[model samples]
Target: MGLLVGLVLTVIGFFLSVLAFVLWIWMLIDCLKNEPSVGNDKIIWALVIIFLNGIGALIYYLVRRPERIKQTGQ
Candidate 1:
């Protein structure tokens, strides 16, 4: 029925939200610990993740992370 469908949707939404949060936290930690602290790279990424939330985290993961890992071998 309608109520059952709503409950299912709600559960899926909740899991998605939790996944996003976990991703954000993981990215933030990775940036802090592994990112080069040579200049402001670590600080900048931290700010981006904090201010932009999940989107910023995803950006860091998809864009910068691979480059950093490849470039630095870290």
Candidate 2:
């Protein structure tokens, strides 16, 4: 029973790690792609995401991401 529990925990940990990694990469790319006008500085945000890891990505998503605009052909 103990062995089975350990294996399950390990698998869960692996998936969480992968999710964090993917989030980090996605945020890094998004930061780079953002226009200069979107926020203070793209380079700074990129560095923050790189250094702070998942937490930084969460912060950027919550604070810096631009609002979506719907465009209808004028």
Best by lDDT: 1
lDDT of 2 by residue, 4-52 (tens): 9999999999999999989889888877775354456777888899999
Q: In candidate 1, which residue pairs clash?
A: none
User: Candidate 1 on 43-72: residue-level lDDT in tens?
Assistant: 999999999999999999999999999999
Each candidate structure's count of clashing pairs: 0, 0
| RMSD of each candidate relative to the true structure | 0.6, 4.0
What lDDT, from 0 to 1, does candidate 2 have? 0.77
Model 1 TM: 0.97
Evaluate model 1: give its lDDT: 0.96
Q: Could you tell me how far off, in angstroms, the CA of residue 38 lies in candidate 2 after the best superposition?
A: 7.9
